[model samples]
Target: MTATVPTSALNLVGKVFKPSELRFPAMPPLGLYIHLPWCVRKCPYCDFNSHLAPDSPLREVGTASVIPLKDARNPRDEAPLTHALPVDLQRRYLDALIADLDQQLPKVWGRKLHSVFIGGGTPSLFEPALIDELLGAVRARLGMPMSGEITMEANPGTFELARFEGYRQAGVSRLSIGVQSFSDSHLASLGRVHGGEQARAAVAAAVQLFDEVNLDLMYGLPGQGVEDALADVNMALGLGTTHLSLYQLTMEPNTLFAAHPPELPDDEVLSDIEDAVHARVAQAGFERYEVSAFCKPGHRCQHNLNYWGFGDYLGIGAGAHAKISYPNRIERETRHRNPQAYMDEMLAQARPAEVRSLTVQELPFEFMLNALRLIDGVPDAYFVERCGRPLSDLQGALKAALDKGLLDPKPGVLKATPLGLRFLNDLQSLFL
Candidate 1:
């Protein structure tokens, strides 16, 4: 038996909400990204926002000389073999990072951090105590969950057992070792400061220290053959790393590699390397969850997953970029690219270097660009939830993709088919 509501109560309950009164859907899980912009030396084939360590002895060396002098550190020096991370500069930067977070906190007030990624040029170069202090500051301000994943990107040349142990003690649950290649020739060709031996040592230390470790490897490198590429994968597998980020070397504009391109493997060899990497990692019980990302079961990178899922993240550091969601709109923000400028701006409490809201017409492509990268595409509901629109809005593009056999024909899932995954760019272009 149901009791009938009064007409007046029913009228109030069924009242239509005005467009302005309706609130946007709740935001996705949030993460934080802290970028350290200085590396011992910048790689020629790299175009990330990394720069050489300031005041290093090799600062004036020609780009071509970077590789040869990579291992020229004085053996007698008891200090860490890499370029020194100035204590004062580190303090200033950490303070600036805290201030930056303070400015961004209101946007995510009361939200717990899902994960944190401390990435960049060579985060391992900083002292472990400093890393601890940085993390402490973040935890104090942001309120990270006890079980949240905190990852720090480390380079082989700066590997130190004590340093790594200290990082583990300082609450870094994961370590991403930049072991680009285990082949000495390939490492040199890529302008890496560490050789095969140092890379191996770094991985060994990371595996022993952290429960979750990711080995970053690049194939199709200059003069690399299928055998060389396979060897790298095999060696990384042998190191017991739980995850791998395998990338193909590309020459981007404004990079030294673009100005004077190295002799890369031909198209055929490049294809072979890709094929071999896929087969080997799969055979070793790893799943290619996303493009360029392979991982053992339960070991996927949460911070990266947040990005691919179009979740909100606050990036606080030099040259860091962020995408945030609000009740009415979504916007992106970026910090100053120059380290000093970023610090100065943060100290001055200035607005972010840039901020822009995404127009409705632009949301679909931007959302798909990230979501479709995953082998298992995002849920259909996310299309409407994250993009602030109905799925019908994408009917034309979806129909075209299905007609071309690029999208799965499932009723409620938005995933690419095998053919679509192979021609990912073309498939994604349909959204635009």
Candidate 2:
């Protein structure tokens, strides 16, 4: 293979397509994304689609005051809201998720879901029985792969060994435990409820119950020195997890962090922290695949891989996002943000989702943003299969990236070299 792999091979592998000629097929490989919005408390450095509701709201918004209405003239107004409020504020409505699933599942009947990922404020806080019910409904309605990857995001403080065993019985095969950091000060700074010991115990429990288990860790705290960051990494490596998601503490918009910014480490210190942690993780036999993810052989998170590889997924629950690829269309969907709103909408048996199509110009960037994350990278066939276009379509831009030595020289793979990984944005910009 040449230093720069030829884009022409993509043309030979599949049908050629221009921006205008591209088409998105329905039923692109399916996955399931379940969102749990509530958290015990908010983390300062976190910006996930999560909410802080120490106590779950009562499910009492319905009946005479609030009614679901549909007008004959306005088809899109099927989910019309009545100008009335429910009298009950004391009722809780978590079961309303079933109503939402009942309404939506029929629309995508007969599709195989390759993976199911339950991410949340803290899914571990929910009763194990509820988890079992949720999984049972999923298996009955949307068929699961014979050897599917079923993952649930767990909080170390709320995690119980017996609960995990019950989850295994409920068909959950993977656990993504959020340990954040093992340092007492770091955990306190991040507002995490779990301690170092709890995190360790959670990992031990998860490894015993699930076939694959992932630990979530964060670096770049407000006062996190490089040594502090390394200590956290060392604790994570000691946990014996099969997978690790090491995220940098970024201050995103709309969060408390954005409003009341903390004194984060300087850029130079941050860079050193990243480099040292990366080196330590690699030395411990974990391969860095995505920017923040590392895993042992055959233990990479399949659900996340499906997302990055551009596979289709159905989002359920509050603030969930989904991408669906039909034979002639690709659409993204999102549920209501508030848990109460979501439960109400689900109870009424409405779509609870709005959809939009991806435009042609946006495809290359989205495709590359995901596919290039793997260290060894994906094969050429994956580019064709995932992007729904011949690999040749990206030749001109990819060639520029290869020439810049930002990409690996492998013919079948699309990996970033060390320098490329460092300057990933610059390489990605070529495709954009």
Candidate 3:
């Protein structure tokens, strides 16, 4: 969520620190994020910056030529689908992304990337060769360690064995499949393009191709029960995924569902579903490392860890955001939201849509906002190192939170108590 506060509000306690006063012991580890902003069709509940592709030739997976949808399956039975993306548009977008990366390279001139995340509105829609070209360009310009994790988000609707194999050969080490649910009824209610069968098939293919796989699941759907939600969780675990990202169905403002809300599960049912899902995942030997992230031992997502740890990242592509830390201050950058506008801006070599430096008053809250999300919290040194503020700066809020039973009394680390985790927003507000 975005907030707008007057600059005067930054004058907290009548004390203000200049950017020049801030200094970090060392720069944090860096990650790279690439966003693809296109989907075959828009979901009614989706609030992401995704758009349906323009009219083009349609083709099925594993085929070299375009084919009518009716020839393979009844065109009337399937949702209105866009054609496979044009190769020219794919190349254009990839080139624009490389240009965007080049523009930001100087910001991270000497840093080596620890991880890369290729996320989107169905990044699987692009052909394997296109992915190879994209990653090739990234490796050419930036220094990615040999052990760096390269993850890409894939949708079941775009899954193909040959394509996934090609991606593996192209240097992708991890795959995050968007398998929201294994229930066909829930999937249809969510406006997903693929059915339960396709989701299963995609997961099967993913486990065979990628050593690390993460499955995205959702609960609290319309007419969903605790049993129904657990069934989805169990199915995903059975598919041999190393990580699970379970989310509750939310109706964000401006989305179709928010305007005409669905009849979702009530609070009681939602709570029951949450408890059951947590218990089941725990029984399966998965740790709830973050609020919605569960992972088996040694499989926590490094890209996300970088974010939660308040490390720096360089985000490229349409609507992407980046947080960069310099010796003197920390700054945030966001690109143009519209795809065409972003491409055009990159071509013209203009400034990003927005850039802002964090004020000293905001640093404590911003650091805690990300760090406290971890179940185990972060080391005390992280706050000092990342925010460039001494532990004494947080002493007041720390004492208050500890007294209120919202923070652990541990000496060397800062972690939320169970009660704090339950009321995280209220706990984090203490820092402000």
Which candidate achieves the best TM-score against the true structure? 1
lDDT per model, in order? 0.81, 0.71, 0.81
User: How big is the positional error of residue 416 in model 2, measured in Å on the Cα after superposition?
Assistant: 2.5
Model 3 residue 184 lDDT?
A: 78
Off by over 4 Å in 3: 1-20, 56-82
Kindly report which residue pairs in candidate 1 clash with one another.
none
Model 1 agreement with the true structure over 1-432: per-residue lDDT tens digits: 011223332233323434333224556678999998888767777778886776444432245432553443323444454546677888898889989989998999878788999999788877888899989988898877434799999988788788899999999999999888998777877777678887898899899989999999999887788888999999999989999999999889988888888778899889999999999999999999898999998899988988887778999888999998887888899999999999999999998999998877777788889988988887766665665555555779999999999998987567889999999999999999
Give the distance in Å from residue 27's predicted Cα in candidate 2 to where it truly belongs: 4.9
Model 3: per-residue lDDT, tens digit, 1-432? 112222322222224445446756667778899999888756666788876665423322232122222332213454433235666777888988988999898898888888899998778878789899899989998866434799999988776688889889988999999888998778767767677887899899999889899999999998899999999999999999999999999988767777777788999999999999999999999998888899999898988988998888999888999999998889999998798898889888888899999888888888899888899888777766677666667879999999999999997677899899999999999999
Candidate 2 has its poorest 10 consecutive residues by lDDT at 64-73
- Candidate 3 residue 254 Cα shift, in angstroms, is 1.6
Q: Cα deviation in Å at residue 423, candidate 2?
A: 1.7
Give stretches of model 2 more than 4 Å off: 1-19, 22-27, 54-94
Which pairs clash in the backbone of model 2? 25-326, 25-327, 26-325, 26-326, 26-327, 58-91, 59-91, 59-92, 59-93, 65-84
Error of 2 at 350 (Å): 2.3
lDDT of 2 by residue, 312-380 (tens): 788888888877776555678888888888888887777756878877667778888877776666666
